[model samples]
Target: MITAENLTKRYGAKTAVDDVSFTVRPGQVTGFLGPNGAGKSTTMRMIVGLDRPTSGHTTVGGTDYRHLKAPLREVGVLLDAKAVHTGRSARSHLRAMAATHGIPARRVDEVIELTGLTSVAGKRAGKFSLGMGQRLGIASALLGDPHTLILDEPVNGLDPEGVRWVRQFVRYLAAEGRTVLLSSHLMSEMSQTADQVIVLGRGKVLADAPLSELVRSWTTSQVRVRSPRAAELADRIAGDGVTVTSAGAGLLDVAGLPADRIGDVAAAHGIPLHELTPTTGSLEEAYLALTGESVEYKTKEIA
Candidate 1:
């Protein structure tokens, strides 16, 4: 398990990571989400001891990262996939990382196969595609077979198939009792893979809870109801403190009210209800709403 207690960091007058606290439990994938320049990178750096925290602390297995006996065996991290040397082959890169802790050569080969990079394992890393480089980085992280993994944007440049492969791989690892803390800006990807979430904005912890709870509690669920008596039904349901949106012809989207209450309103007015279904708010909608003020917009070419 990994835990951060009131952790913080500052750069001159600006605070990079403010009093943030969250727990990443084992046997599940915990997604770390934030807008650009929201101190996510700084927080991750402190967790692995790459950068010192300005205050508070973060621990892995109840011990600080620097205090671990074998850091690689305890936690494997992949901050930047492109940090590998361009001249070396994927196999050589893995070998060098494994040599640091006296890991076996068989382990290197096993990870190479596990990441499906064996076909290009012997080729120079510079010649590899973006997806291939990501695989190589993942292989290096798995060389130690650590119990906890901290990956930053693991699918940034992956193709559709490669992205799906990574989703399943991380899920499988967490299922085996490993703690996975994934940092990514991909809302759809996180929605599919993460069990819980920790949201940060401007160096401060904004929200932290189970994914389902966060979505349920922070978002306004809207139900779309359609009926032939659109005018009378909408009139009966309107102005009762519930926010209702008309869908033109004969449809209405209901919000700020429960399904039962809508039914009661319809029954009180003797309006025939044709449809009533429970609606779920999307994770993306909730995330955007939570971090709306912190988002940094950029105009880049569409991929």
Candidate 2:
């Protein structure tokens, strides 16, 4: 597990990360989400001891990363995939990293196969594609078979298949009672993979909760109803706090009423209903709502 208590970071006169605190528990995939310049990278760097915190502290498994006797075996981190040496082969890179911690050569082979880099294991790191480099980085992270994994944009340049593989792989790791802290801009994939999420905005903790709770809190649920008597149904359901809006021909988007209640009302009024589907707010919607004001680099909509 990873724990941060009032973690803060400052570069010169500018504050990169404010006082932030959150726990990444074991047996779960905790997603780290935020907009650009929100201090996510700073926070992660502090967690792995790449940058010293100005105040407070963070720990991996109850100890600072620098204090861990075997840091690789305690926590695995992949902050940048492109930080590898260009002259080294993928296999050579992993072997070198493993050698630092006295990890055997067999573990390097295991991770190479595990990351599906077997075919290009002998190829130079500079010759590898973006996706291949990402795989190599992940292989290095898994080299020590650590209990905690911290990945930053692991799927940044992956194809659809590679994306799916990473999604499944992280979930599997979490299921094995390991702690996984993942950061990504892909909300759809994070929604499917993460059990809980910790959102940061402008170096401060904006929200931290389960994915479902976060969505429900930030956005509303809507029920789509299609019926021949759409107008009548809308009128029937219209009351305090309840809203119904027409959606083309025979459809209506409803709010503040449950599906079963709407169905009962339709049945009572003898309204012929074709469809009544409840649509909860998506993770993307919730994320936008939460981080809308936190976006540092705003782009104007094209006219």
Candidate 3:
């Protein structure tokens, strides 16, 4: 398991990560989410000892990363896929990384096959495509067969098939009682892969909870209604704190009111209703609601 206790990082007068604390348990996938400049990468670097924390601490299996005797065997990290030697072949790169940990050549071959890089194993790293590069990085991370995995945007350049493979791979690893900490901008994928989510905004921990809880707590419910007298029904139901929009012919998208309430109002107005369906908010909606104000870069909406 991995744990960060009141972790903080600062550079010069600016603080990159601020008093963040979260635990990543074994046998589950934990997602780390944040906007640009929200310190997600800084926090991951601190966990792997690539960057020093200004205060507090992070531990992998009760020991700090720097203090681990065999760090690669205990924790595997894939922060940047491009942080490899361009002159080396894919096989050479993995072999070199394995050599540092005294890992066997058989293990190197295993990871290459496991990540589906067997065909390009002999190709130069610089000649690989973005998806191929990511696969190589994953192979390197799994070379040591570590108990904990930390991946940052593993699907950044992957196609649908590659992305699905990663999702299944991480789930399989976690099922074997390993710890997985994943960071990505893809909310839809995270919703499917992660059991829990930790959200960071402006260097602070905005939310840390189960994925289901995050969705249930942050999202608002809406009701979709279709009726011949949609406009008349909308006019009758529209009231304090409630909004009804004309979606199309004979269709109204109603918010700030429940389906049953809308039905009651329609029945009272003697309006014939064709359909009334409640819609639950998606992960993207929940994320937007949580990080609405924390977004570092704002764009003017088109009117």
Q: Which is the leading candidate under lDDT? A: 2
Order of quality (lDDT): 2, 3, 1
Cα lDDT of model 1 by residue, 107-137, tens digit: 9999999988889999999999988888888
**Candidate 3 structure quality by residue, lDDT tens digits, 146-248:** 9999999999899999999999999999999999999999999999999989999999999999998998899877899999999889889889989888899
RMSD of each: 2.8, 0.8, 2.1
Provide the lowest-lDDT 10-residue window in model 2. Answer: 69-78
lDDT of 2 at 211: 97
| lDDT values for all models | 0.89, 0.95, 0.93
Candidate 2 lDDT tens digits, 102-148: 99999999999999999999999999999999999999889999999
TM-score for each of the candidates = 0.92, 0.98, 0.92
Considering lDDT, which of the candidate structures 1 and 3 is the better prediction for this target?
3
Q: In candidate 3, list every pair of residues with a backbone clash.
A: none
What's the C-alpha lDDT at position 81 in model 2? 96
Query: Which ranges in model 2 have alpha carbons more than 4 Å from their true place?
Result: none
Query: Ranking by TM-score, best first?
Result: 2, 1, 3
- Report the C-alpha displacement of residue 122, candidate 2, in angstroms: 0.7
Model 2 TM-score is: 0.98
TM-score of model 1 vs. true structure:
0.92
Better of 2 and 3 by lDDT: 2
